[model samples]
Target chain A: MATKLARRRSKAAAFGVFNPNHVVGGRVAGLIVAFWTAIALLLWIASPWKTLPTPPEVIHALHDLWWNDGLGPELFTTLKLIFHATLITTVLALGLAYLTVVPAMRPLVQAASKLRFLGITGLVFPLTLLTGGGYALKVALLTFGMASFFVTSMAETVLEIPRSEFDHMRVLGASELLIVWEVVVRGTLDRALEVLRQNVAIGWSMITMVEGISRAEGGIGALILNENKHFRLEDVYALLLVILLVGLGIDALVGLLRAVLCPHARLGKVRR
Target chain B: MIPGASVGEVVLDVKEVGLTLEEHLILDGVTFQVKDRIREGITTGQVVALLGPSGVGKTRLLRIIAGLDAPDSGTVRGLQGEELPAGTVGVVFQDYPLLRHRTVESNLLLAGSIGGLSAARSEARTQELLKTFGMEDRAGFYPGQLSGGQKQRVAIAQQLVVPRRFLLLDEPFSGLDPAALEDVSKLICEVANLDEFNTVMIVTHDIRAAMAVSDTLYMLGRASKNGKHVPGAKIVGEYDLVDRGLAWQKGIMERPDFVALEHELRGLFRTL
Candidate 1:
């Protein structure tokens, strides 16, 4: 019995330490560190400067831009556009999805599906002619480019909620509208948020395209376009880095919200 | 709890109900009566177990009674000839079908709101149910965080958030551990006995669970003679619990009378 106990103990020791609680946290930290290191290496190699901007130099550049160039307002404008676009997409997508399930409104949903193939960039001429430059044009471009996918993806998410859930709500005395609110909306909210996070990058790309064409007074896209025209390679690279950082930050914030709202989703290994 | 409805009376009747799917008859002239049973102001709620083998149309029969699927002929009524109000019959589906994104407490609140309860009433009922099902600690947890037993309890509790005329549990004991099965059966007994619940019908193949908690037993099986394909299956036997006073008591299965009754129930199934 003693030999058996010793053998078991040795086997456990050989297998290595196991801290089940911290495994997920440790792995996530390692991944983040590795990712940042790879980005820094790429930036260092690509820089034309004799002395590449080290981590400190990049941090200083971020600080310099924020204070001297009205970068704060530009960043805020870009963020505001993306935020509203996501909000509009969420509401409109959910509404379209709700209507799709209704027999009377199903044809309207079918008609909306055709928008999936409608190209936003191709509509630039008419959009500029109708809405014209500045905020309206930007929003219209972003909405037109992204709303169709959002609506279809959200509708599919809503549809995929098992029919049994709808039946459960009905038997519990819920009306058709009530089922739409409870079973359909609450059921799809987290998934819809995830889809928005995935599609926001596409929205960002569209924002850049629109800004480049129309020359907005402010926004990161305008900053990038201005930097590009002057051939300020360092400034352009720095602005791109800023864009990448801000995008990641926003995605992380949305992920945090998802963690809070749907705690069981366990979306990330990193501990809150 | 709905106005104009009386407690301690027959609330649901499935009379000569026939259902067919794609030319395959599922329930043929299936009939059952559920009376609200109360003792000393505590509903001893009548648990009528619908015992049947797989593919014997138990689920289809349940759907018909819940009014989710229309029967080809005959009638299913609540409060005599009056149609059941929207929330009269709450069904706990076999898989629980919980809103995965919402916390346990919010799920109950959602159900209450859909049932037209006031905000204050919904909040009160949500807390009450969370406590009743021994899930107060898990109120903040989402469905994905729960064990099978906890999910099952929440599913049933959400249905009861609004006082229902009848509660239908589909295969409630399918995947429970022995201890969990015991706990769930006890909960069913306790909840059914509440004045708010008139009748609780459980569909299960687990005779032990049925024998432990149900006051009435119903067995359903295919009746094709000599291995022929029967078009439909019907109720085979019904047993009253009045004679077996100790059936609900723990370890009742070890009792001679309980064992004898279990044998008798198995005998009916064997003949099918």
Candidate 2:
């Protein structure tokens, strides 16, 4: 009987990471940071860096950049860019979602959304070919590309909304505009935010790429590109530090918004 | 379409209305009408329910009535001599789709807010609903944080926020078990008789739920087959259930009338 009891418990315990203990471990706040830190350190060590300045030197360089090279204006520019991107993406995505799910336009929206995805993907390549060598043009192209995704993912999220929620909102006698504002917008906010957050990192890289190609002036992206092109190892490390700190700050902001706008609720068990 | 039509003037008129979805005939040749008047104390209310098995279009009927869906073959007429503009038909749908992002307070504030009522006015109405529903304590909580029952409570609160007589409820009691069902049933009864404008229409297969709160009940069938550009689905029967008083349906659901009603409803069609 005791052996049977142990055997019954064995399979239950055998499942990895789904054990209750693992659930508790997963919920710990900084577990992800710890895991990523270990991986990042491993990558840093495995990759060549002797000739490159160390992390501390990079930090000092970031401070110097802030103090001497003027971090404030560039930071403001990046912030402004993101804010505009977010706003434009939100309004356009909302309209696209509403149009996409309407039963009459459901098929057309479905077809159009598919076309838009292809169109947006096509847009990305042309930006590479046409916007040949201007950082400002590249920024515009990248922002446009980012907005296209906002429309796609957001519209998809909007389209995939549980039919049940849509029906309930209608039963509540919510106007079409009201449905867009309240139901569709709220339902898609978390997902749109996730896409926004994901693309933010991508945006950073894109900026650096533009700077590398276009020789733009003064932002951290430009700083990174400038340091690397000129072979200034110290400045490269300093710029990397700037990138790291800024990335973390943006990630933290995303987390704050998630908590404020998408925190766990009882129904979160069912829908995101 | 006069601005303020009176009793028997047809708040909702469905004439030979038929609906089709993905080649499935959900409702066919369905026709019905209701007045705009809430029942009062010491009097039977103008509460109506649509009862039928799943896929029978009990909800489709409600949707047509609520103007959430336009009938493929017919038109819907609203209380003020035209179909009340969308969002004008206060409803409590089966799933209790509360805005998960909003607080219980916000969930309850929907109608009043959309009606352009003042913040203070809507707040007061929300307060009244919260107090009545015993969810005043959860006012600040998001739907994601609330239990299934709590979400339904908020949904109910949303439907009741406006002082309109018209309503469309779809399987409002199916999600709740016996005890909370009792509480919700009682609350719905109280709301139905709140003396605003009037008629309450519900769609539910649970006869006991129908008999408990409805003044009259209609039964739609599973898969109507009218066979037109739109196939046919139809309302099989309409019933008057107002004779049963508040005390009649109290604790015991196994009573003769209850059992008979259940048997009668089950006899209607397939389990859908």
Give the DockQ-based CAPRI class for model 2: acceptable
- Number of clashing pairs per prediction, in order: 1, 24
lDDT of 2 by residue, A1-272 (tens): 99999987665544533544343233442665687889987786566857866666666877877788777787666566555655655565556666765678667545544654553345555676776635445565556656555556666778678877776666666666778777777766777677777766666556565445444545566666766778878777776666678877987797678667776422454311
In Å, residue B188's CA in model 1 sits off its true spot by 2.5
Interface C-alpha RMSD, model 1? 2.7
The 10-residue segment of model 2 chain A with minimum total lDDT is A263-272
What is candidate 1's lDDT per residue for A77-174, written digit by digit as tens?
A: 88888788777776776688777778798677767756879787678788888986677777777876777887777777876888888887777777
DockQ of 1: 0.52
Best by DockQ: 1
Give me the displacement of residue B264 in model 1, in angstroms: 5.2
- Where is the poorest 10-residue window by lDDT in model 1 chain A? A16-25
Tens-digit lDDT track for model 2 on B117-215? 798999998899899888989999887777878877788778778676676766778767889887877777777666644666767767777777665
